[model samples]
Target: MTSVKDFRVEEEPTATDLGRGRFVFSDRYSVFDWGEMPDHIPNKGASLCLMGAYNFELLDVNHVPTHYVGVVEDGEVKDLGECESPPTEMAIELTQVPDLPHEDGEYDYGAYHEVAGENYLIPLEIVFRNTVPVGSSLRKRGEPADYGLDTEEWPEEAVDLPEPVVEFSTKYEEQDRYLDRDEADDIAGVVDLDQLEELALAVNHILTDHAARAGFAHEDGKIECLYHDGTVKVADVVGTFDENRFSYDGQQVSKEVVRQYYKRVQPEWVDAVAAAKQEAIETGEPNWREQCEIEPKHLPDEIVDALSDLYCAGTNAYVDYDWFDAPSIEDAVAAARDLN
Candidate 1:
């Protein structure tokens, strides 16, 4: 096994050598490097593992190339004796993208670039939005920063243009940047003008189609692509609320689930979040999580339960498993748009 620094072993689902491959994932989730904050969105790790595998299978069905090897079959899962949890519901095999070296001992983006070669982590983000949901950074900013709708942080009153706004996200900076077309193409070199639009269109179309069938509207979404062996196929989960914006019955229902929990279960943190946002403005680039001196925030039982339920609901809604009568893709999109 390659011994890498900071490569803490997770016992829950150990990644045995199994020849040239392994099944591994992190318990870590970062919104802004608020590292290991003692908050666990119960089932979040499993949901991601399961949902990511599910999407990988779907993409395979769609003839999209991906990095998934296969999930652990019924007999492959084992307990590491650390704790008792459901038998992982499901386990998956994933291609190991070696951790990159960080500039400040951070995750090394450059190493990621080098190791990935031409099939590098395209330092580009494909963002799609369906509606201006409440509590959205855009909504919360209250017009001060426009999300580059017309220009970088355009005025609050700027009406959205004719097209779903597109921006180039920088891969290097401490903060991701939203750049204009020229900046995206000429400067970024991550993608060309026509190609970016085409890629974005394909991603949005597929996710919207999927979301629509689940009785939701496919407002917008994003894709992160790598060149990978000379072809571009979907590289990440396509339609999850974490990756895209979606609504239920004309209501903003995605991240709101988690946000509401914070608001209700940890109302005190709301002021902290707001203050962090303000600090972010002054710093030009903000990492609110780092500013939290109140380390390892506790998640209440109610909050955990709410988040778990939300994850389950979101996953079910996205998959349309007949667990619920989600509409077909077309019907969902139409219904979602009817809200406007």
Candidate 2:
């Protein structure tokens, strides 16, 4: 399947028409919709595989359906035997992909809905939030009070919510836009809006509990689902540092660490990107990247190293295993904090 991360898929001709393939994870990471940046974080692929498998196993035991079959090491399909860390590849069941065409700057979701009969990836991202963090998109697009916070303005620091909030956003579009329940229902023709919310919240419950046990705060996360044979299954990697926002004692222990570093180092480019997005919303045009003439500079070596350590260290702590020889999570967090 195509993804921002380097998760490759290769079909086996010998297998039945029911698709079977290997998901090859890589050290590559993406940020700000920029796919496959120039650097590779050491052991990042292994860390993600380990964490994704961990969550998949948990969901399976809890009776949540998923596409995960097994992990692949040395070309052998095996159980996630000992969760020290995973190899580069994992086996999974593949599904049909919807054809979403765009012509003359307009997306033809109607055609996609018509073609996507019953088994395909859902064209919506169900996002759930437990807190209003410093760089939350909610702060930019909505008022603090919209989420039941008592303040007229969001604080500079993060603010915790009394309860979790669930929302939907367009997934396959060039520029993802927030959607109301009705809008989400219209795009996701096959799946009911209520059922979508139910599955998303169920996942949130499991992950939030897991994060609590790991001593990390699960601030928020998004999960993707697949509609297969009249059933919706959680289809993608979940509960990784990249997929979810986790914090250790108020310091970010997830990819937000990298995002914070970039915002500090590339303030002008970040501001330009934000302006371009706002302009796109105001003008109802989806080609905002063309208007944004700024190119992001490669992250400095020091920042990259710091982020690499953050990923490895955080993964170790979350999985309760020293899979990599890295600094303690506290030390890594301190180093990332010192970057400013």
Candidate 3:
């Protein structure tokens, strides 16, 4: 099981073949790579599943290759429209995810690729940004000029990019870190890094336009892909609030809301997590959590309810479907702001 979802492999993929599986998304949420949180946001699982299915279908219409098969409802895989109610399970084509060999305080991707062969989940995440929002890592990684902003420093608010910026980060590392193009290309093995970037940009364009139509700003998102038969197909979920950052009327309408809430309410735990990560880097320790003494506190019930409404409302707005009887996105965001 992943941090927020339980996965079942009906057929396991071989080194050169595809398999079958389903992801049962739970109401569980995670922040700061802390595995699972103490509370579950009501309806969050169904919201993400429906939103992911919607985006996958939209991508299919745009001729984007993906591992999505359909949503699972009543023990059967069905198209999003065919599902009578909101779904929590998603059927997907499986790709081999061989354990990345780690030794001497370094990950051996060459060994991983040799075992992964042609059919595998790419060990890199492709991120695309349409806007450099406050607290964005891009601000620390690049200069304003690097992103085409004609300013000496980054603005206090979000800045729209002249063009979508694509980036790569390690997926299987103890602590995911950004990688340069050359390193990313080397890690990608036989998969073309340029093609991956192109695919990520296409996804960003599609999601950005979709969010605009729905009156939301899609700031950024990342996607993982599976390489099979010399083809790259987007794997896992896409365009969901959990996977992307969205804002409505200058307010966060995505999981960032919850993360920010934690930052405000549990600052010590957040700081400890960061410090532990740095300590791990210096100490060559793989498990950073072991070094952190602080543990996260549970979110207030009111905050959880507001976030639940936000997820459902955002999904309803993005997909143009009323899957949940929740408040409007505006109302949801307002409620979240009040709680925070």
Candidate 4:
């Protein structure tokens, strides 16, 4: 079924006793809290599928357990082969998603965690940041000085952190909110906070090392974990463009490109969306659009084409294969930067 991201989960026939499903990635893209936007970035799905499977394999090599099984190739589940223009479906072990009910727009996460017990999602998105980029929530939420930087304020450009910073944010909520360690620990229930943090760091290191080898700066990323059998394993897709922020030559090369495009081209709409979200928080109502009376406009065709090229070229570069006949990653990133 459809979820926040532009993907559908289908039950695989081989999943008889095994709780397995296929994540059929789509070309559709989403930014901010908006669901599928009007524009579709071509080859985006293939890029994510390939990159995700690549990272999953890397994690496996590092002896990290994950829900990833393999990619569906030639109508069968098999190892992810050479990079393809458009990757095939991906298989993952399924886990229980317990109901997290809300009362009057306020989530009862404690009760939800109680019901979740073990063998479920940890209910927190562990975010690991290596750099604070422009428009990063960290810039707005805290000061650079607070992060041990000499500057009292953050610069307009991205600034690398003195050390990697790991934070927790609520997942599966209407509006995901960043949480302090104690709050996160309580919500995560049986999962040990320190162990979870270690896993996030390890996963970040894995992705960061690979990104460096691929000539991209792995600025930040988030991962979800599955707590099963008294152990926590990396769950869900990891290290894709959508899940992580990557930069090339000081320019964002990930989905941040789309977010920046919207901020520049549709400032009014973006501001309206932010205002709506704030109003929702203040009023405790879920329908922010009704309160704000604003709708996000679709990206122009040229922007969509640029994004498609970026995804394809970036994928090719990261996978080190001629997956698509597109411009080089540098050229695509330059084009995107020109838009900004």
TM-score for all predictions? 0.62, 0.90, 0.98, 0.92
Q: What's the number of clashes in each of the models?
A: 14, 0, 0, 0
lDDT of each: 0.49, 0.80, 0.92, 0.82
Task: Find the 10 residues in a row with the least total lDDT in model 4.
Answer: 9-18
Q: For all the candidates, what are their Cα RMSDs to the real structure?
A: 8.5, 2.8, 0.9, 2.7
Q: Candidate 2 residues 153-269, lDDT tens each? A: 889998999878999998888788888788889887878888888888888889899888988899999988877767888887888888898988778877777667678888887
Indicate which candidate wins on TM-score: 3
Runs in model 2 lying further than 4 Å from the true structure: 1-4, 10-18, 82-85, 140-145, 278-291
Model 4 C-alpha lDDT versus the unseen true structure: 0.82
Displacement of the residue 205 alpha carbon in candidate 3, Å: 0.6
Better model by lDDT: candidate 3 vs candidate 4: 3
Ordering by lDDT: 3, 4, 2, 1
lDDT of 3 at 217: 93
**Model 4 Cα lDDT, one tens digit per residue, 31-98:** 77777677778888888888899899999999998989888766677777742335658888876667
Question: Alpha-carbon error at 178 in model 4, in Å?
Answer: 0.4
Residues 93-207, model 3: lDDT tens digits = 9999888888888999999988888898999999999888888889999899998889999999889999899999999999999999999999998999999999999999999
For model 1, the superposed segments whose C-alpha errors exceed 4 Å read 1-35, 74-117, 135-163, 186-190, 250-253, 263-290, 322-340
